[model samples]
Target: MIEVAGDSSRDGDWALVRLRVEGDRILEADADGLGARLGGLSLLEAAAVPGEPLAVDALANALGPIFRARRDSGRVAVAMSGGVDSAVALLRSGPKAIGVTLRLWLDPSGPSAERACCSPEAVLAARRTCHSLGLPHVTLDLRESFRRAVVEPFVRGYGRGETPNPCMRCNGSFRFGQLLDFARRAGADRLATGHYARIVERHGRLLLARAADAGKDQSYMLARLDPRRLRQIEFPLGDQSKERTRAEARAAGLEAAGRADSQEACFLAGDDLRAFLVRRGLAGESGAVVDDEGRELGRHDGFWQFTPGQRRGLGVATGTPLYALRTEPRANRVVVGPREALARRRVRASGRLFAPVERAEVKLRYRSPAVPARVEPASRGFVLHLDQPAYGVAAGQAAVLYEDDAVVGAGIISSSSAT
Candidate 1:
């Protein structure tokens, strides 16, 4: 027999539940604290009790360890984001499915914090959906870990004058790592999500491939996922379109059927990136905008505000138009030049390749088209030699390499050269 206790406090309401269990049954159950309602019943029976918000919150928070000993091979854990896509994913996961959500950190001052996928509102929505479907739900509070793994690097990257993609970083490492760990603790063998990417086996190795809906393919964003873990991950909407997901949700009367999609940088909570950065203590000092020939063009608030390929807000007037070519944070200077000057034939990146390849198509940005490139192995990473001079390649962005529709490798752009 083992004894376990769980407690939760919210908005001045608190509850504590202690359970003594042997195998899958709770032998002795005791509940105390304000707003708790587990009296005169087995704690195992209380697990399914309804209409008691405080009791549900305390029990759901404690279910992770209580279910850890029983390894149910057929059980699956669904990652819920309180949206139509994830709602449909849970429905398709069959009856033996459990819903899980990660409570991540968001800017408290942002106006749209409630719209973020990891906000308290989203958590309640997910719990409600699971209960509506007669399924159990779990919430993992991972704000500190998320701030460390994804938010810190994003701020530091921008401080160094690099346009970092925090979504890619979170999806690739932090999010899946936590979800899979939760699945294991919940005695689930598989983890399913609403990602619109498919997994395919190539030469006995799994690789992420583009989804059937070309316009919504997210393989590039998920390219950094460890290929070995693919066997345990499932994408229920991999072959379907976003419209189909919404239709299924509507048919099932799910509340998230018409909910808008979450924003890219969820932590920003719908605030402008510049404003968010400033709020995070990344306020910049006045700097100079200069041309390639070392002539000062104008003055700007900060060099970090500009990124490669940016054309507007330079605050400079010349005979010809100028684009931001690069930012030197050390010198506090923004370098401007002609559009042709942004062309680059070589890119150096720091990451790993899941498969061996000599030639592949590289996507420098999320919305940009893939360009054919020759891959050359480097000291700690790899170099992409473009067939044609690609323009506006920037440092700190992901360079995802693909062979046809399958992702072969991905890396963070460290530098680029004309070569």
Candidate 2:
């Protein structure tokens, strides 16, 4: 059993809540008779009552001692996202775990900011999960850095008519890099996250592989990570199914157990990407939708809004269903054709590999099946010649190559051509 107490103040109303927890369940709670059922509520949640005032950062400072003790205790820094997966990860890491949440500055002009992963609301929820377990949590403010590192690139990619997966860049590069640095500074031994992926050794080199739950595998999003950093990272949930994680959290009385999963683009937070781009001053311009031979078929508000293989929202209906073949940002034109035109047996990708390979399975898109392909070494990048054609291959999207469930290498699809 553990005991925790914290103060909360909001809009001049100050209150304090204290709780006693026992084996994943709250035994008793006292909040000056605020009528809160503190049994299942985390300490931070109890402090977030209506008219209760408590700054999230201040709460972290108040709970600093809980973390300071673990600094030299071989602690593992767990990245919390205010969700069940992360909460269970911390639980498995034991009391020597410290929770860390990065607060990013989301687009102010977008929809409800509270919904995003790095929003203030999420940070508080994550802190609550930590406090419930008598563990310490810290929030890192990375608003400006996040904008420069992730958001700006996202806007620029869309402006250039390239469909970039911002999440991949964030997780593979920025997010994990920051977390690893934080873990080192905090005297922690390792950095852990709830991502459904694993690290395994292949021929004396560290390699990332799919999680036990293939359906929830996030290996593709992390395929671009610098391999040198793999040894210091940990994914405790890699072998557990999402269903089992949820069940563990629910058994522990964690509020996050029932929380919905976060959005793919945390910055978008359920807002339309096109609308978000327009608000960020990357608005699209009216353009012509043309056939492959440059014959105008219809008019479009903007070519940036359409991606290769998209069949809906074309605004121009041909006699048959049409798909976006390619987008020309220079001409501000969108090329539309039949679905068959989107097929490609070859993809020239530009990116480095974690390991050299002569043959591997190539996955063009997240949900698409991995196809058998021949990998040829090239000067600037590599080439994938698939045994069978795949549809909707687009530039700026990641082409991750795998060998026996391990992500051997990955690159951006620079071009896709018909066989």
lDDT of 1 by residue, 1-419 (tens): 78887777778988877777676666666764323355444423344455556766677666544555357798899999888888999999988788888989987776767778998788878877888887777778888889999999999999999999998899889999989988887788999998899998885688999999988888988988888889999998999999998999999999889888876678987688888888888876888999998899899897888999999999999999899999989899999999999999999999988889999999999999999999998877899999998878989999999998899999999999999
RMSD of 1: 2.8
Cα lDDT computed for each candidate against the true fold:
0.84, 0.80
RMSD of each: 2.8, 7.1
Q: Clash totals for all models, in order?
A: 0, 4
TM-score to true structure, per model: 0.92, 0.85
Tens-place lDDT per residue, model 2, 244-270, is 999999899999998889877889886
Model 2 steric clash pairs: 8-53, 9-53, 9-54, 10-53
Q: Model 1, residue 415: displacement in angstroms?
A: 0.4
Query: Against the true structure, candidate 1 has what lDDT?
Result: 0.84
Model 1 ranges off by over 4 Å: 1-49, 62-69
**How many clashes (backbone atoms < 3 Å, residues ≥3 apart in a chain or on different chains) does model 2 have?**
4
Assess the local accuracy of residue 356 in candidate 2 as a C-alpha lDDT between 0 and 100.
77
